[model samples]
Target: MSDTHRWVEIERVEPGVFRARNARGGELHVAGDGGELFTPVELLMVAIAACSAADVDVITSRRAEPEELRARVDAHKVRDETGNSLRDIQVTFTARFAEGEAGDAARAALPRAVQTSHDRSCTVSRTVEAGTPVQVLLA
Candidate 1:
């Protein structure tokens, strides 16, 4: 499917805090260190985790509806002469299914589902892996 045009407006609310508003009227609070909200890096990690979880959840549910699904993403950062950047990212997805053959089927599909999400699905993960380009405009 082709991606739709998406836009978000960001306005500074304070010295280090800003509010981001999407076309849907959703708002997100963003801030730098010492501010009260999620930092930019934290939000990036959250995006990755959420994207992967969504893909895995959908794929697994097709086989067997899961009682619970959780996803965690861990990132390692390094700052050196080369500059600061994330060195590694790891994602862990956990799911619980009903106690029956359905559960067994879900369990059996878990590994493959995760693999497919990481390797094929999950746009955020794929974009990060591809080193997506970013452009900043002054307004």
Candidate 2:
């Protein structure tokens, strides 16, 4: 796989359901019916949040491991004449550290880590915030 290019192949598993496979053998199921699998919109939100969370964790965890860490993404799914889109997307993170000097160091680093991720390091959230044109073609 080329570093400059990322790709995933999605194949229909059944009506209203599909599986997306990456070159590294990662797979996720997407479904539009019955709420059994992750919907495409949810996957998008997950990607955005996970990217930032991973960035923040990698930076902060070096100081001290977090006792608890979680990330959540919220947005309005809008459908209108313009088409379906997400608006006012927000990613939130909750982190906790054990009581100790190392924990204090990590606690102090948390805000900066999150800020840096949101402002620069995280590609997914940055891309979403900056916006980009996605070109689709038949294959």
How many backbone clashes does every candidate have?
A: 0, 0
Q: Candidate 1 on 20-128: residue-level lDDT in tens?
A: 9999999999998835689888888999999988888887888898998999989997899988788789998879999888788888889988999899988889999
Instruction: Report lDDT (CA) for all predictions.
Output: 0.88, 0.90
* Tens-digit lDDT track of model 2 for 30-106: 99763878898899999998998999899879988898999999999999999999999988899999999999999
**CA error at residue 2 for candidate 2, angstroms:** 11
Least lDDT summed over 10 consecutive residues: which range in candidate 1? 32-41
User: Residue pairs in steric clash, candidate 2?
Assistant: none
Report residue 110 deviation for candidate 2 (angstroms): 0.6
Candidate 1 lDDT at 23 equals 93
Evaluated at residue 14, the lDDT of candidate 2 is 92
